[model samples]
Target: MFCFHRLGLRAAAALIVGLGIATSARAEFPDRPIQFVSPYAAGGANDFLTRLMAQHMGDELKTTIVVDNRAGANGVVGASFVAKAQPDGYTVLMGNSATHGTNPTLYPDVTYDPVKDFAPIGMVGSVPIVLAVNAKLNVRTVAELIAYGKANPSKLSYGSSGIGGTGHLAGEAFNAAAGLDMVHVPYKGDAPAAADAMGGQVSMAFVGVASAASMLQSGKIRILAVASPKRSSSLPDVPTLEEAGFKGLYFAQWYALFTRAGTPAATIEKLNGALKLALARSDVKKAMASQGADAAYTTPAALNTFYRSEVKRFGEIIHRLNIKATN
Candidate 1:
C-alpha cells in the first residue's frame, strides 16, 4: 500500500508537469517572427505605413516582423493571401479601404469575405482623397473644374489608382453631384495617375493627398477640393467637397490591421495592445502625417464595426455608379 501510494503521487506529479509545459507553450504566442503583408508595392504610402507599424509593434511585441509586399489586382492578391493564412496570429494584413471596403464588391470572384474571414486588430490611419487638376488646365477650384467639365465634355477625364478604389468612387460621386461627364481612367497605382494628371494626360486625378503632395510643390498639379468632410491638416487651404457646394460626399483612403479569423482572442488582444502602443508614439504620428495620413487608432471591436459599415456603404456606391472591374 505504501508503494502504491508513492506511485500514485509520482503519476500526479508527472501530469502536473506535463500540463505546465503545455500552458507555457500556449503562452509563448509569436515565438517566431511574424509576417506583415502589405498589399501594395514598396515605397508607396501603404508600404510605408506597414513598415512603420511593423517596426514599432515588433518592438512592443519583442519579435521581428517582416514586411512582405504582395501587390496585385488592386489589393486583391495580398488580401486573399492573408485571408487564407493560418489563423495563428503570425500573418497579418495591412488592409485598407480598397481591400476591406470596395474590393469585395468590385471583384465578383473575390476569394474572401472581408468581415467574415479576418479578425480586426485595429485601425492605422486615413489619407483624404483630393481632386487635383493639371496646372495647365487653369482650374483653381472645384466649381471651376465642374464648369470646365460641363463646357468641354470631351476634355474632362479623371484618373484613379484603380477601378474600384476610393479615388474612383470619389470621382464618380463628384460626377453625380456636379452633373459632369468626366471619363474614368484607371491606373495601376496612384503615382501613375497623379503623374498623368501633372503631365496633362488627364484633366484631373482623384487621388490621395500623398500622391499629389510633391507634384503640388512643383506647380504642375493643382488640388481643387478635398474629398473628405473637413480639410486635411496637410492641405489646410483646401476645402472639402461639401464646402465646395457638393454636400454629403466624403471619401478617404483608410488603412487598418487584420489577421485571419479564428485566431485566439488572447492573441488578438496582444496584437491590438501592441498596435495601440505604436500608434500612440509621437514619432509614428509625425511620420504618418508626413505621408499625408492622420495617425489614428480604434479598439478591435470598433474597427470591426467600422469595417462592416464601410463594406456596406461602398457596396451601395458601386452599385449606384455601375462600377465594374476591368480585370
Candidate 2:
C-alpha cells in the first residue's frame, strides 16, 4: 500500500509538469515571421509608415515583420486579400483611410466588409491633405489658383491618389466650394499623383503631406493650401483651406493596423500592446513627424469606434458630392 501511494504522488507531479509545458507552448505566439501587407504602392505614405512601424513593432514582438505592397483598386485588392487570409496573427494589414474609410461606399463590388472582415489592432497616424500645383503654373496662393482654374477651366485638372481616396474627395470638395470644373485624375498612389503634378501632367495634385514633402524642396510643386481645419506641422507656413476662404474643407489621411477577423482576443491584445510600444518610441514618433504624419495610438476598441465613424462620415460626404469611382 505504501509503494502504491508513492507512485500515485509521483504520477500527479508528472502530470502537473506536463500541463505546465503545454501552457508554455500555447503562450508562444508569433514564433515565425509575420507578413505585414501595405495596400498601396511603395514610396507612398502608407508604405513608408508601414515599413517604419514594422521595424519597431517587429523588435517589440521579437519576430520579423515583412512589408508587402499589394497596390490596386485604391486598396481594394490588398484589403480583400487580408480579409480572406487565415485568422492568424501572422498575417496583418496596414489599412488606411482609403481602404477602411471610403472604399466601401465608393466601390460597389468591394469584396471585404471593413468592420466585419478584419479586427482592428490600433490607430497609426494621420496626415493632412494639401493642394499642390506645379511650379510652372506660377500659382502661389489659393486665391490665385482659384482664379487660374476659373480662367482656364479646360487646362485645369486635379490628380489624386485614387478615385475614392481622401485626396479625391478633397479635390471634389474644392471643386464644389470654388465653383470650378477642373477634371479629376486618379493615380495608383499619392507619389505618382504628386509626381505627375510636378511634371505638369496635371495642374494640381491633392495628396497627403508626406507624399508632397520631398517634392516641395525640389521647387517642382507649390503647395497652395492645406485641406485641413488647421495648418499641418510639416507645412506650418501653409494656410488651411478654411483660412484661405473655403470654409468647411477638411481632409486627412489616417492609417491603422489590422489582422483578420476572428483572431483570438488574446492575440489581438498582444499585437496591440506591441504596436503601442512601437508608436511610443521617440525615434518612431520623430520619424513620423518629419514625414508629416503624427504617430497616434489607440486601444483596439477605440480604433474600431473611430473607424466606423469615419466610414459613416465618408459615406455622407461621398453621397453629397456625388463622388463615383473611376476605376
Q: Which has the greatest TM-score? A: 1
Measured against the true structure, the TM-scores of the candidates, in listed sequence, are 0.94, 0.88
Give a tens-digit lDDT track for model 2, residues 38-134: 9888876788899998999999999899999998877889999999999978889999888899999998799999999999999999999999999
Q: Under the 3 Å rule for N, CA and C atoms, how many clashes does model 1 have?
A: 0
All models: lDDT?
0.92, 0.90
Pairs in steric clash, model 1: none
Best prediction by lDDT: 1
Per-residue CA lDDT of model 1 for 1-327, tens digit only, reads 999999999999999999999998877677999999999999888999999999999999999999999998878899999999999999999999999999889987998899889999999999999999999988788878777778887678999988898999999988988888889999977889999999999988999998888688889999988988888999999889889898878899999999999999999999999999999999999999988999879999999999999999999999999998873
Steric clash pairs (candidate 2): none
